[model samples]
Target chain A: MTSVADTLDVLDQAGKWRAAGKGVALATVIVTWGSSPRPVGSRLAIDDGGNMVGSVSGGCIEGAVVKEALAAISDGKPRLLDFGVTDEQAWDVGLACGGKVQVFVEKVE
Target chain B: MKLDTLHALATARTARQPVVRATRLADGAEALIYADRTEGALSTDGAIVAAARRALADGRSTTVEIAGGMVFLHTQTPASRLIVVGAVHIAQALAPMASMLEFDVTVIDPRRSFASDARFPAVRVLQDWPDDGLNAVGVDAATAVVTLTHDPKLDDPALEVALRSEAFYVGSLGSKRTHAKRRERLLAAGITDAQFARIQGPVGLSIGAKSPAEIAVSILAQIIEVRARRAEALQAAA
Candidate 1:
């Protein structure tokens, strides 16, 4: 688990980005399964326009995750996004593994 | 009086570098400072330093009474960051493990040939001189600076800058004798013995590492050990 100080650092930096009029959303990987790209507690930050500062996966499902994160940012709501490599939608989303991953998307103020 | 004492207590607990909160024995301002840095308080500098040092050494969180007030020091290591001043072979192996260890790794070197996406795909590689590169990354208490160039023209200037920064660990890849000679050069350039003491010569622990990757592992291992030992010491003090 990351320390409060570290999390605060990210929040503080994100705040600066937001102050600069950038759209920033915080995406946290809450769960992962076999062969998942990122472990739980991994974070990927996305700006309002969909520019990514970090990665939630090993580049496996970032495109889909970013879309979800962007939607959450626009709606000012949180989203729980799940993707499994075995699902047909996973193929549509370009995931190549049987492992499942869960991401929580929250827009940063 | 309560607020004053609480501030003192917090300062006392934080002198060693752990994150601590001091609740006044009576009632007053809540003084929060990292265990390693407790300043702007009266009559508690020594205590804060002692407490922080002890808490950091222990690597655990604790609640205690300092100057008759309750204070808590959390001896958790901040995410370690590695600032490599050169993009050499050793850095390639070192960067990934450091990432695995949760270190925010940044490689800085002016040589475009050495600092390229192909060489450091997973790490942030900067094609700038060490001085400018380090400034961009913003060295702090949680950062470690390693000079791997072995060239005085490059390593010396880099060491000169890093020694003055807040980076907790500053090591150079060289033998002790080499460091001794390097010290002479630094002294000529106005770096004092006290400042020289800040550098870790012979870089990593005496692990007899031969290959670049092995040496990189040894270096990071030493960094982690130093971090852990600092936590332990702080815990004991608390």
Candidate 2:
């Protein structure tokens, strides 16, 4: 319920940010496999100023997603990012439960 | 995401309408897919729209490899709800538990004291008559209704309303003998046997639950089982 409401908030605020001349990027978790903190379709929105709403993997990988989302907002390029426990940097930002998540970060036009 | 697509999503959310946003992974092309209409760059793709419909029904996001490219269908559906018709002792245990499980829970009873916010600290409490409370809440396919009041006067009205609505689950707490008597009364009130059969009597799974908390656990488990079975059947048919 909180996730759904969070997404609703993201959509609503994204529109406001876009209208107010602020760049915004939306990141969505498209795939999740095993023990993921958030389910598939969870979202996180990042503004040009680094403000964020909603979550993709709760707290596990949001920092990385926000970084990529800010880059997407800057470059106007969409990115399909993947994070798993198997990655070399997994120790730094990997899921504690060893789940895999695929996120699509796209600039909101 | 285009401005119009975002607006359409906000519109769909407000209406509680199911939606799927299908994104082509090859390019960043996306489409807002509703049952009757579509918008965005890839709106003309029939295969993607069909897949989107399937994902919407399944209430799951999926990645499908189509002929041209892989597409991710992200689905959004209304939240599931739980309506406890009697703010009784069992409901005191059930309401918060259901809320914790992410069901929008509401406790309804004509007795003000029973349905007070003090009784149900977190869940919504409605002191309206059972039927009126149900009407105010508005039952839907994503909703589950449970009649926890053992009194026929209170439970039967709620049961009659629930049995007629599109609520996915309807259960009433009572003994076998009490259920038999209730069945007769409902039958006399013009409720068909088919409709009456929808009520799960002596509510909750027979897990030898002794206390109110255990009974609440059993009931919630049964609701989850029923919903999962229904979803499996729907997906199989689809």
Candidate 3:
């Protein structure tokens, strides 16, 4: 679980990125099932160029979430993405422990 | 993405104030709410603000149904604070352990030799009288005050202040007999039975703690127990 201070730090960075005219996307763990690495309410912020801060899955599904976050930034739309061990490619994405996480990615305007 | 709201939240976090961030799930509208006031524009309704305030008091994040939509209230509290009222041997062990547990620790002692940076390298050491030092730090519900000095001159004054404060935990190191005598003295000094009951005499969980380090562990365990129980109660209420 991310500490409250760490979540605030990510939010502060997102604000800074938005102020700097950089497109920013915020991905938050909205739900978790089984033995997910990160708990619900963890957040990750991604800038236009894929620069990111914080973690939603403790390295288990950050890459996938960041990809979706960058996509949300470009499309200027929100996306709810779910990843779990049931997927065929789960081992490649590091979620092979029967855990599932639902992330909400939204553009920070 | 409101910079003003984020900045205000950051400032509150820096000031160690309990605050909550309420975000509308549908549109992502955000607001910063404290006990008495709110910043930004999530909603102007009193119900939303009141829910946010309740979340802040509970110290937990939860999704609450409001009039128009569901809002997620993320409550943030300052780091837990531990104020050791004596720069003693047990403090030497306790400070680091508490720091590792994310407590902002302060060790106070009137004796300069004991309350030196040399003794507590990375901790805040205050060279002042016990009451004066605690007064300067200011205890609240998030703070735990531990008096390690057995001296009545130091520990008694510190206890007098701590028992009256809103600190979640107030503990003093002494034997049962010592605590009984100390209790008599405090009663003579006008401390009531109810107020004196708030203190954890013998200072720690009875886990056969012998060494200073072991005693520190026991004390920290007891503090954690109290803290966890409080959180559970709050969760139940929420």
The candidate maximizing TM-score is 3
lDDT of 1 at A26: 67
Model 1 global lDDT (CA atoms, 0 to 1): 0.70
Tens digits of per-residue lDDT for model 2, A44-63? 88899999887898698999
For candidate 1, report its TM-score: 0.50
Better of 1 and 2 by lDDT: 2
Residue runs of model 1 more than 4 Å from their true location after superposition:
A1-109, B1-78
Cα displacement (angstroms), candidate 3, residue A87, comes to 8.3
Per-residue C-alpha lDDT of model 1 across residues A22-90, encoded as one tens digit per residue:
877766665577888776546677777777766777788888888887887788666767788767778
Pairwise TM-score winner, candidates 1 and 3: 3
> Which candidate number has the best DockQ?
2
Q: Estimate each model's TM-score.
A: 0.50, 0.75, 0.76
Ranking by lDDT: 2, 3, 1
DockQ of 2: 0.33
Local distance difference test values of all predictions, in order? 0.70, 0.86, 0.84
Candidate 3 per-residue lDDT, tens place, B115-223, comes to: 9988888778899999999999999888999999899999999999998899999999999999999999999988899999999998999999999999999999999
Query: How much is the lDDT of residue A19 in candidate 3?
Result: 81
Best by lDDT: 2
Q: Give every collision pair in model 3.
A: none
Q: Rank the candidates by TM-score, best first.
A: 3, 2, 1
- How far off is model 1, as Cα RMSD? 12.6
Q: Note the DockQ of each predicted structure.
A: 0.03, 0.33, 0.22
